[model samples]
Target: MSGADFIDARAQGRHDWARTLGTVALTVAGVAVVLVPTRLLVLPWLQANGADMPEPLRSGLLALMAGLIFTGAMAGLFLGVRLLHGRSVRSLVTTAPRLRWGQTLLGFGLSGLLVGGLGWLLDPGAVKPLAEVDPRILGFSAMAMLVGFSIQAPAEEVVFRGYLLQVARRVFRSGAAAVVLSVALFTLAHLGYGLESALFSLTSAIGLTVCVLLLGGLEFAMGAHVANNLVVAFLFQDLSDANAPSAAGVDWTELAANIVVMGVLVATAAVLARRRVSP
Candidate 1:
């Protein structure tokens, strides 16, 4: 089903905790498998393949942690959707009719320009290095990043806004509380992003929660998330310096623009969702 259809279904009533919990449990199981590496045979095989014990083991641990989070989120979201017949939770497995190309481009363009502009003004020294990587390595790196993000983003959306927020909404009977919890969980999930990105992720998380409340469903968040990953993976070449040093205070210009644009979008979406869901 399409994202719009999923949202419409979820808006009908409340979500079910039992199905949601089942989903969470299954996801947890999956994460455990990835993290713990059950069979004694598995470690020997990895060692034979030249997998760095310390690095691969460390990476696997981190991956396991991240995978667990996404798994829980996915389970919760789908459980809610299944229970509510798509009424109380959105579907991350679905896609919407393409947003108007112009509108989508405009949104992305504006956000990038604002962020880049702010970087230029507040941290001029941080202009990214002219990417000098070998073409093959660059291609491979891009592919790897794309694959990682593709698997991760939907999993995250389903868990955070789709399942957890939906369940919270049922409990609180308030949109704001659910959004807050979702944002907090989302921030916690980014613990692997390091201190700076985690901090920015929290800010971004708040922005996203507001986006959800205003925009009415997970679709918008998914789009924004994809757009962000695409930029980091394809457009900007460096991963090491993703967060360059910045000026002491927030960039008012970029911050203001982001607030205004997102605020307007959210307000419009919330109004529309209200109209659709209300009698």
Candidate 2:
């Protein structure tokens, strides 16, 4: 199979209208359920305990707790895929029978190198210390971020690229149609980001989707997605409200740089996949 080929032999009878629509409903419901902890459970706790902390620390606390809760989305995704689509979780995960650990790591490391390198080169020293965080809090928060983003990003890929793309391709009966609609839906989900931020996200969605399609699975894309989020979030931790990562105005130059990074990332993944497959 070549990088451009993505029709999984395992998903033959899976993607009908009902299941596709159900995936959306279930995915959204899953997110809403997961938010319960962050909004209802963690918010009060953080507010009560972190009253004296700097905005960044409180924000970090919110993310830490939320990350733990966000694992629900992955569960919900699997459940919906099973109940609604009558398919195994593996259908939405990889073209292969099981997950590919090596590709996942490759995607994570390569995308991180490109994105973090470009970001630092273009806007050096953009991040500043949010506050004089306690050593314990800082250490814990770092781990929390890794845990949270790891689950959060992959869960998102399962819903967006995995579930959505597969269903759309089945429904529309065109790879182009599936790709465009999936990318469009992903872009629309980030309407809160405004035009520039939406554009940035759109570009990113395309890149990650390309990575998934090329690698014939979600492992690499999930890893790339997580790495992308990590660089953007951590480097800019103190620059903006954690609650609103896009609250800070988007800069055109930064947007341009991000697009380039995403584009290069996609291209690199394609090249890497081709080399491994044919050579």
Residue 120, candidate 2: alpha-carbon lDDT? 78
Report model 2's TM-score to 2 decimal places. Answer: 0.85
Please write out the lDDT profile of model 1 over residues 215-242, one tens digit for every residue.
4455555555545554443443243333
161 Cα displacement, candidate 1 (Å): 1.5
lDDT (CA) per prediction = 0.51, 0.71
Estimate the TM-score of every prediction: 0.60, 0.85
> Which has the greatest TM-score?
2
Best by lDDT: 2
Give the TM-score comparing model 1 with the true structure, all chains together: 0.60
The worst-scoring run of ten residues by lDDT in candidate 2 lies at 1-10
Residue-wise lDDT of candidate 2 within 1-279, one digit each (tens)?
432344443545476677767766776677788787577876777667776775445545555555656676676667777887787778677777668888789878987887778887876777546456667766666666677778778877877787777777777777788889889988887655457657877888888888887877788888888787776666555423533545457778888887787787778778867886784
